[model samples]
Target: MKVIIAVLSAVLLHCTQAMAAAQTGFFIDAPITGIQYVTSSGIEGQTDQGAYQFSDGDVVDFYLGEGPSAFHLASVSAEKWVSPNSMTVTHTRTINMTRLLLAMSDFNKSDNILTVNQAKISQPAVQDFLGELNLIELDTLAQRYDIEIPSVGEAAAHLQSSYQYIKQSLSSDEIVYAPRDTELRDILIKTRNYQGHLCFYNVDEIDNPSYVGPVGSTTYKITNKGIFEYPDNGDRYGSNDGVIASCDVDLRAKRTEEEFHEVSSFEGWSGLFACALKGCTRTNLSGYVVEEYDSGNSYKYRANAMTFNPSTQIVLNKKQGLGQHEKVDGPNNAEFIWFTFASRDVTPLSFEGQWQEKQINKEGVSYRCLDIKQGQVWATPFSDSHCRARNSAGFKNASVEFGDMWWLQSSAKDLYFYHLNIPVAWKDSNQTQHYTTWEYLPVSDSLNNGILYRYQQILDEKDQSLRTSQVSELTKL
Candidate 1:
């Protein structure tokens, strides 16, 4: 009797678990509406309130229309909230699904409640257009329909396509076929409006907020208009003619809370070179060095010194002499912190002009001028009071011109600046030939108390180790 009771209890637990897994869930990435979904367990229906019912361990496939003319969108795992990010299908399918939703949203421009028309999508021409459609062609269709689609690329007025009419129809669906649920509609609208930049790093975290990590990290720029550009060399310095893609990207506020915390200034250093006239002293630095920038005219930062000694070995060689130290102070240090606050009215084109360095005196504090001209960033010394007048006259012979710099404005009107291809020389274990490599500086903006905080990555040349460290603070002037 005892054995039979134990077996029955185990069976009941299994059934309960199975039933919980098969519960109803919603599809989101902003709660897509009026789409058909089929589960692996053969459960099929149109998503009501973005809802779907499925058995445990079921794979859900989404579609547009029914039968022969149906367009198979994405196949993803049956979960509480299925989204493009949750898709189990290939990346191509995920991208296409996202594009389709974006196109639908663009068509229904009055609100964020994305409702698709089955009659329009089921048409033969529309199916053909969707089959051959690439992301770059969305804008052309938007214009033909006299509708605006928020994208990251420039509008090509003369872009010709054979399926132009089909695209236009898809962009401007005439009949509202689906039932409107005001309560459900509001939920979708709220989710869509709250969407921020789809970054590689979680923007919610204060530490490692942006893509400030290892060398192999994905480095791409998405403009306010929705144009996505991925540089071949990983840094967007020289030219953006490499590869262009489009997505639902926006430059929104990364962090919502208003708080400030200081991180280690020397978070990525393996060792420090304490050099003198006669000889150089090498001291292995461990852990992190936090610096407070409450008030200071000059700020000091670290860079990767070009050397063959591995970071692991350098840490082991604590307080040891490493011959005569070369006067190798690279262009990694900036004399003054420059702040650029972009108003909501500023467009990408208007923000791309040459910026001259101006001496700003705020709260009785004088700062050096840092200006940009034709992608080159010129940093002037604070000692030179006449830097502003000279900068107006084309100060080509400035103190330092960090090559090929760029800036992007976020949706919250915060501006981010970057310096690319800064050279760092290093050697291998075999001590073969001295090779110079480039490093990228992605400026962080953690704003608090009228001051914009910036963090920079310090690289260890020997082993290519990288860590994000707080470098500078910019106060609004």
Candidate 2:
């Protein structure tokens, strides 16, 4: 059951009357009829992180416009203290409509009661509450026999019923947020005035639950549907020649616990090196390392999955070391708190979990290296270079060679590269172990791929760019 405990805050009075032209055709110019504030503590204990509660106030502003009388809750704002507190809010249009229905002389005071002749405003829910307040309940025979009671004065009857339905529904664990439409009607009935005068809409009591948080807690922002447009027409070539496509994507990472160590240090060890030392900025990475081997112990590899802070690119190393991260792919300098690195160069002949320094023959030159996988050096006596020596004509077919590989060092120096074997898979499955997940999905093409690459020339260099790279879908799991 989801029970919502609404805590009302102490009333802070600051009512002002300001006149402005109506933005819609149905706007009104009613003076300040009445003002009131209400706060609520959300359900659950106070210490529950991210729990939401709120404070709201009513605005009795009325203006003249087209259409029948109606009211709406426009905005809600809350205080910012560490403990929850109250904030101000507005609901003008709905108040005006309810006032019109009541047909009262004054808008703010709850002194007078006007009769509603038409059944248009009296709904089934409203009638149910009125049945409880009828004078028929005082009759002995009616009470003894448990007879049904008819609705009283229409205005009060409907108002009471509307209020009761909202209260009952709100108190139930079965309900989450209040139904915006049903509650809007209650506001309309309470704020109506027949003489075309706007009035204060108030109820002496409301069945808000116990205040759970401080006082005012959560805030809500209101907006109409006409404010934005999502252009999703299966535009495959979303971006090109100044045009952009809509897209979004998510990436995850994994590592082999046995094969990798959270590189403690990589200062002086060597055989081959591939370090990125661009603008050494810190990045948050969340991925895993992997270990692979073969008969000759040679492996080929690469970093496949990715996501990082666009401000700082992600960096990885075969051996653990401390340094700033640089962008390897994605944005120019995207930073990531989530990343994974794997060694794609090297073959393991035999290894033992003992730290050792060793050398491998690459083009007759011995290079120094260390392995966290076995934590032992490669013994030259037991080593055999299985150089299949296939057609090395730039990736034509399958082949192997025990020669030196090359890569760029952080100092922009050319360093011997190695061959490592790393495996990768692409899947966006959300299986949470602790925290809730919210996926920000960007628009995808017909194929449902989150990324789209297009060739374009902003100046004279034609290059590929990711178009419409923004969040387009969201869901909590």
Candidate 3:
């Protein structure tokens, strides 16, 4: 939740003054009416991590979204804090929609509540607590007893809202950071409303509003369907042009964990990295280091997966050392923990868990599955319903969510270059693990692969500009 707080610092401000004008029809500080959920958890204890406990079928209404961006917690005592004494304190947090979706995802076990732009947010403790506040004990509760309940999906969303109450409250010294997205797999990040530069829209445009919207700006152009159009320096192309800019996507309602189709195609590591020297900075990665290979063997960069390489894959002896994270959406010092209030995690989502829950879907897949014999079959490593690799090449309406954390979409499809969040991981020669929140733009046409180009770019952070050092790539297991 530390990284989430930092992202929210900008997201809260951005959404407040987002493109929504007074005349535009959008909810502003609107209250979520009819807010109520199961009240108490009859079972009480702590998880292995020492978090508060709840019955498997507990009912709770942690808080309600007072508006599109504001939230209120009914009770703080039920939350997970390092200290149980901290629960007595009640507070409201200025969480942005991005982080809110993440919290809701873990709490509700659904990652598609809202669209994540560049990073993934996870608070396992939040999910654990909220998951308990469900209508599980409907027969026990008088309000729900003998009453027809909503379908699992509908109930899932409503029940997930219970996280508001149990969501952790950041202390005075607590700082928030974004959870890492990981490497080699295709990931997506949104450019709209973000301070980052895009193939068509650069930060200079915001600094100097010389031209309005996409057409007036000479820097880049947009298509009828919100796609960007541009001349390529090479043969690469999208939208029948050199490249295409797309939007961030939401996987909120696509599939369920009931052995459905696999949502993500690439099983390899997917993450972001920063290669710039001077003005560049990096910070705040979450979770533990996943020992992909046996600890004694360490890790290796293979032929198929490359985190920093644009085309030619390089081999790394151990994990390369990472510097500070370069600011992605906000200021260069994007990680300043000004917001004292930190959100507690309820329940964190696990990759293996998501994959296990994932069922197969064939609508947008690129590869034909030989695994499917007659009826829908559960996805296995061999028969996985992953998205086609080439289809990721220059996609038209593509979006991605890796490890259920980060989300990205193209700015426009026509542009030749892109600045994106690529996931990277490695162990230092010292045997220390390192995670990179890569936010580099590959040179023109280098990012044309529709399968998983993170996002479009501007002239300043172009692909041909920088040379990324070798780190590690996720090989196909």
Overall lDDT per candidate, in order of appearance: 0.33, 0.19, 0.22
Residue 96 error for model 1, in Å? Answer: 6.3
Q: TM-scores for all candidates?
A: 0.28, 0.13, 0.17
Q: Top lDDT: which candidate number? A: 1
Model 1, 236-308: lDDT tens digits are: 2111342221111122212233232322332332222111111121111111111222235433332111111
lDDT of 3 by residue, 272-379 (tens): 222211111111111111112323433321111111121211111111111123322232110110001001211121111111111211121122211211121222
Sorted on lDDT, highest at the top, how do the candidates line up? 1, 3, 2
lDDT of 2 by residue, 1-477 (tens): 123222222121121111121111111111112211222222111111112233222111221111122111111222111100000001111222333333322333352222232243244333332222111112322244343322212222333333333233222232112111110000001111111221120111112222111111111111121111112111121124422211111001111121212334434532112112111111112121222223253331211111111111212221111111242122221111111222221112221121122121111212112221212122212122222222223221111111010111122122111111100111112421111111111111111211111111111113321111111111111
TM-score of structure candidate 3: 0.17
What is residue 187's positional error in candidate 2, in angstroms? 34
What are the runs in model 2 whose C-alpha is more than 4 Å off? 1-36, 39-122, 125-243, 246-477
